[model samples]
Target: MENLIIYPENQKQLQILKSLLEEMKIKFKSEEQVEELQDWQKEKILKGIKDIKEGKFSSNDDVSQKARECIK
Candidate 1:
């Protein structure tokens, strides 16, 4: 069986989803119950945040220009 992930925007939506899944007898796990991020994932996220703070990332216009050049 394929797996699916759902993000409920609010507590009401989360409750509704939980209730619906229970009623349907479909097994599912909440975000809190899921495994934590791997070490590499955490490191990559931290590096990205550091890069943003250091202004090491490209701007939207720069990225778009590069994409257009690539497509030419």
Candidate 2:
């Protein structure tokens, strides 16, 4: 892996890399590769949607006080 080096200094280079990596199925093995929030946040949103679907929680007044605080 030490032989691998990425220097995306130009649009052509980037496009070439995008194609080559896509063709080769080369994967990024680095921490920053995750690039966005992890699975827990996605799970929380899914759970909230499921709760709303199931009628498991809440009324407007439950959140209205917090919403009013935003105006202050």
Best by TM-score: 1
Report the lDDT tens digits of candidate 1 across residue range 1-72.
Answer: 689889889999999999999999999888679899999999999999999999999999999999999999
- All candidates' lDDT scores? 0.94, 0.81
> How far in Å is the alpha carbon of 46 misplaced in model 2?
0.7
TM-score of each: 0.57, 0.38
- Looking at candidate 1, the ten consecutive residues that score lowest on lDDT are 1-10
The sequence of per-residue lDDT tens digits that candidate 2 reaches over residues 1-72 is 366768788989877887888889986543356578579998998999999999988788978988889999
Model 2: what TM-score?
Answer: 0.38
